[model samples]
Target: MGDVLRRRRPSRAVAPLRRDPRASGRFQRSHRRLDLRQGCVGRRAALLRWALAEMQRAFLGVDCGTQSTKVVLRDPATAAVIAVGRAPHELIERDDGTREQDPAWWIDALRGAVRDAVRGERFDIGGIGVAGQQHGLVCLDRGDRPVRAAKLWNDTTTARECADLTRKLGGDRRVLELTGNLLLPGYTAPKIAWLASHEPEAYARTVRMCLPHDYLNLWLTGEFLTEAGDASGTAYFDVRARRWCEAVLAAIDATRDWTRALPRLAPPLSVVGMLRREAAESLGLEAGIPVSAGGGDNMCAAIGCDLVVEGPAAVSLGTSGTVFAYRAEPAVDPLGEAAAFCDSTGGWLPLAATLNCTSATEWVRELFAMDHAEVDAAMASGGAAGLAFLPYLSGERTPNRPEAAGVFVGVRPSHGRDAIVRAVVEGVTFGLAYALDALRRAGVAPTEVTLIGGGSASDAWAQLCADVFDLPVARPAIVEAAASGAARQAQWAVEQTRPSLAPVTSRRFEPRPRRDLREAADRMAALREMAGANRL
Candidate 1:
């Protein structure tokens, strides 16, 4: 990247290197080979004085989500992703509100993804970082083996345990004071309590408890460590204090020492450990390479979208919907409407999340026996008119109503398939709008909202975000914000420098706020408040 590394012109007497067609796009021994022997060292140095240039280096970013594991090879020099690989995980679901995945499945997927990405590429990988879905509990035995399947964020089996823990710690407001968020079923703390009661044997075997990303870090670096951003979602971590709250942990289980069981918290911007030999061999990486302490998916997305400062908010529309904004200090909502989370940048990230978005649309599509194209086309039609949907086919997180179900208001006998689809999409968008309002109430006034994730691909969804929130919704050129953020963190940790690549919107959706949107938001809230558990 400098003059010293630049190749010089060849002299008239010197012949250029020859290429072999049969080399399969690679260098052959005769065409270009360097012998590192002592005798050939001088000759090798002289031969390279006028021909080849330095190869660009890259970093690996791994995003381990609920449904899949995605890996990206990003070149920091160009701020571009060179290659990507993805592998899916099978979600294990039972009738009793249990959803899980084998921890081994994640490891296999991670290794396979690396192999898939680097199969034919030739570049130096400088470092590695991982961004994982928050709140999933991955328990390990004394031998570092998984004790059981990891309980996912949507698993509702721990609702009773969560309630019991909340009761022990005091009510909702008191719990918020202790943890900066509610003790919901989706959080890690409740899962631990669930294990202690329902699966006592497994609880006894779980010597170490870690979030999904922390487990990946352990496998990569042989270090049991976690960062503040991911740890904040555990429902036992104090966002303001930036540490685990002992009182909350005691409420979960007074008999156990959680400080010893939980992974040690690593500094947000630091490199927790180096890549170990075994993991390196498995992932085709160099041993002892630095691995940064990447944050949770939302925190990493903040970095990817350049939301490190307190300006624009980020909205991720994947299986779920989440809106997060950065702040200099913790924005603890007294009502627990927005989670007072910590970002990886040592700032606060006040986040409002919904448990439904694309998943809600998917449910409607399945019920109607329609495909993606059909749903997209239908959403392009006129709005649902007076109809409004709650879109809570599954329970919701934002309203703190785990018993809530889908509700449709003002549906007429003449409402057709197109209107139904419009209502579903609109309902999902409105839910996020309500969530964004929570952030605003907590003192985050974002200039705009950056849309990312799978749902951002839909023009209909992007336009709805703009219309619903009454703010410009921008979509970045990069699709994998979480993975991109992980790589950037790793790059910064190693080089102590980052490129001047701010987020640029490839497409911008300006606001055309509908009067009906306000009415719909009001109706949804009225339903949630009046009859969260009843159809009446």
Candidate 2:
């Protein structure tokens, strides 16, 4: 891999989307070769026409998220989205700190989304890429069937395993030196440890361990491969070295034979394989189309927002909240709060992630029985004098607390519904602020933050984030940044050249004069102390 990197030329020029004007007309003429009188020939001609049409238009990007699967078709020349489609999936949450999802649903959702996205379109897709939720443990048996439901990043059932893995590896510092990350419950290594001990039968049957995107890649191309950015979150990969850390694997009690279960490492912009015949049929695409080795969602989002430089940073508000910056080289955190990850474009991504963000707001919206517009209205009318809320509903990661729960302090009879709603919104924003502080501690100073995700759609939330973080906040014109990034990555893989994607800001929220949030910050500190004192 190092040799490959040494031989490859670094080009900053974006790949030009290849277009052939006569290809479509020639493809249509080829159908004339088949006799329309025969039924079989007619069917064959139709399939051929579909395949040829797909080769002429744009690249495809699919984002398999925690709550939904989203697909986007983009014009390769301008990096502009042509069409989009989405399908939601249910998350199985248990009372005992368990979050799981069936892998089959992802396949179904992907096909459904692709079908919807390409409806009434006859253009050919150039290449395909996938950006999925990171740190998910997808275990497959020898027959390539899932052993059980995949445990998600937010699942907290592996706390004991995390601690045990750290102890086995000597200590936190040693573990960090080996993998550039501490053994957190959300990482893939600790989840594997938990499975080995808690469900030995399933562990024994497991033949391959893959991240969410890797599983999707396998379904698409019949290959087991992963890229650096997503692999870095596994706690079994060396972030700086860009390979699996054997020491970390040994510490987790994975024998030499078990290490074979890991996926092969591929470069982010390299084509891992061609689309399989069956998968192509299902997706209404060509069977021989190239499939790129895509990265984690955050890494792809960085590409979408054009955060390839050192100063610009981004905040993603989805199922999880993340504050990430680009670096020319690997940037490891001494405290292991900010993740040291590889970028999709062979750079570095230093980021801090929180477990709760828009999910907290979703809970609040359901609790109050208000639509998004009403919630925005409430935020507009409310002030910050009533109470403080802690948005740790699924525990936290940046603060490294796995057992903390959501809490609201200073609630009084005088507090109205608007106040409570505002508290929830403010709490989530504060969580992002804390993540930004973590990034700053790691020596990353961003001039401003580019906000993307579902929460960024709210004007109130954008202004509140700007005020709380004390930085200018800008939203991108592209709504599906991750999917767009995936499409860009696909083009890069096929062309072997990088595209210059400058972020186009739709709106900017400048910071306003605000009172000190020291009181709210202190409340957060006190809660952390309490959680520490009563560590589970």
Judging by lDDT against the true structure, name the best candidate.
Answer: 2
RMSD of 2: 7.8
Give the runs in model 1 whose Cα sits over 4 Å from its true position: 1-54, 533-536
Q: Mark the 10 consecutive residues where model 2 has the least summed lDDT.
A: 8-17
- For model 1, how big is the CA root-mean-square deviation? 8.2
Alpha-carbon lDDT of model 1? 0.83
Per-residue error for 480 in candidate 1, Å, reads 0.3
Q: Cα deviation of 314 in candidate 1 (Å)?
A: 0.8
lDDT of 2 by residue, 1-536 (tens): 22322233322112223446667875555555554534566677667555654544688899999999899988888878988988777799987789999998888788777767876456567789899998999999988899999999999999999998899889999998998888999999999999999999999889889999999999999998899999999999999999999988887775646557889889878999998888876666658788999889999888888888898789988889999999998888888999988888898899999999989999999998999999999887745574888888998897888888888888998888888898888888888888888888777988998999998999988988888888999999995888888988999899888868676789999987666465676776676677667742
Q: lDDT values of the candidates?
A: 0.83, 0.85
